[model samples]
Target: MTQQPTNESRLERGKRALAEIDGEAGHNVVAALADIAPDFATYLFEFPFGDIYCRPGLDLRSREISTIAALTAMGNASPQLKVHIEAGLNVGLTREEITEIIMQMAVYAGFPAALNGLFAAKEVFARRG
Candidate 1:
């Protein structure tokens, strides 16, 4: 099996992967990416979404949950993390599960990221209303 690259330099991949799951959110992610690196979002559209997100191995719900966990683990990504939290909810991850996940992250990702994740989750929850 070939190992996939986790290097975020592949912006189009990120955009594409994210777009597959949530097109509007993917575009918003691109907008956010503009603040960091303009070219990055372009690749996200191609690689991550087009290649990874469209893959048949994992279901959307599982992928979204995994993404939420991964983002929480990365830390210092309140904005993107929030997006994933919303994605998680959209995919049917319950609030209890989300809170539990965030709580679990506190041990590995530290208190700050976990706390921030909870706050981000709250924001996403509010937006749903």
Candidate 2:
């Protein structure tokens, strides 16, 4: 049988996830998440960062921006996409650049999706301010 992960392995995964997200994780993230479901943080690191995000080619910022575009194209995902848009910003995407990307989506993803994306961006901007 395959070996199960130890608690240490889980924490390592968690740390890796945070690193992938911010490129440099702060103590606050681990301290906060560790207070809640420690496993959740680990899974974020193990699956999202270590497994999926660790894949070759795309940098984290590109991944964040691309995810924003895809979620906007999908539509009916304003709330979730809004979160991702904020994540894009956290990853260093400029407002103008994100706006241009959203606008460009209109051609293929349709006006409704683009509109929702714009609204989401507005929410992110407002929240940031």
Candidate 3:
């Protein structure tokens, strides 16, 4: 039988996940959140990174792809979408692959959403370059 892992404090777990995911980017996100709602910032780190993202089933690269797709579909999460595009690259996705995924979204998410996602991705790529 498998032993259950001991629980850690939310912020502690979040810190670990943030480091593993992409330290600089995660810190930047949290820092931006700090001035407005520190509690929500904590939740952002704790839930997404600490709990869901750290789950064992999917690898980080796969998770980033799924996140990119979901954010693209949402159509209104441009800032968050751009962050995930960069995160996708951090997890080893190539610019070509990321662009392909965004283009694929046009079929289901419509041209508007796909176009916005592509633009967000373009900005991320441009910034990186």
Candidate 4:
């Protein structure tokens, strides 16, 4: 987990990381891209999960927090936001922690974005129940 094995390809490393972080939801996102942009799925796996997420500087929980914050700020990435919110939970983020993180975004991302993020969180939470 510390380093990508020398023998593994980026795709392999990414797939492993994606499974660890996003689980089924991550696989679904990649699968959905199969018909339209298969290469994009490879890119998504390689760059974010493989290259960035595997870095040891931040733990998975911290990474998910950052991701949740960024997606919430974007305000238009509800689908991505929901996926990451679930990912956040997968990586040990509590519902309270997730709610607080989105609420804090209101200062910078505005109330609308925060509200949207909260609603997305609500949906994910409801589904998990």
User: Which candidate wins on TM-score?
Assistant: 4
Identify the superior model by lDDT, candidate 2 or candidate 3: 3
Q: Could you give candidate 1's per-residue lDDT for residues 94-117 as a string of tens digits?
A: 988988888788999899888888
- Could you give the candidate ranking by lDDT, starting with the highest? 4, 3, 1, 2
Q: What value does the lDDT take at residue 112 in candidate 1?
A: 85
Candidate 4: residue 108 Cα off by (Å): 0.9
Clashing pairs in 3: none
- Comparing 2 with 4 on TM-score, the higher-scoring candidate is 4
State every prediction's TM-score relative to the real structure.
0.74, 0.68, 0.89, 0.96
Question: Could you report the Cα RMSD, in angstroms, for every candidate shown?
Answer: 5.9, 6.7, 3.3, 1.0
Residue-wise C-alpha lDDT for candidate 2, range 1-129, written one tens digit per residue: 012244445446545545545533233444578877777766666676555555667876788778888988998888657666666776778889889888888998999999989998988789789
For model 2, the superposed segments whose C-alpha errors exceed 4 Å read 1-11, 18-45
lDDT per model vs. reference: 0.73, 0.70, 0.83, 0.94
Candidate 4 lDDT over 65-127, as tens digits, reads 999999999999999999999999998999999999999999999999999999999999999
On the 0 to 100 scale, the lDDT of residue 127 in model 3 is 91
lDDT of 3 by residue, 1-129 (tens): 011246876677767777666657778988988889899988987898777877787888899889899999889999889888888888788999999989988999999999999999999999999
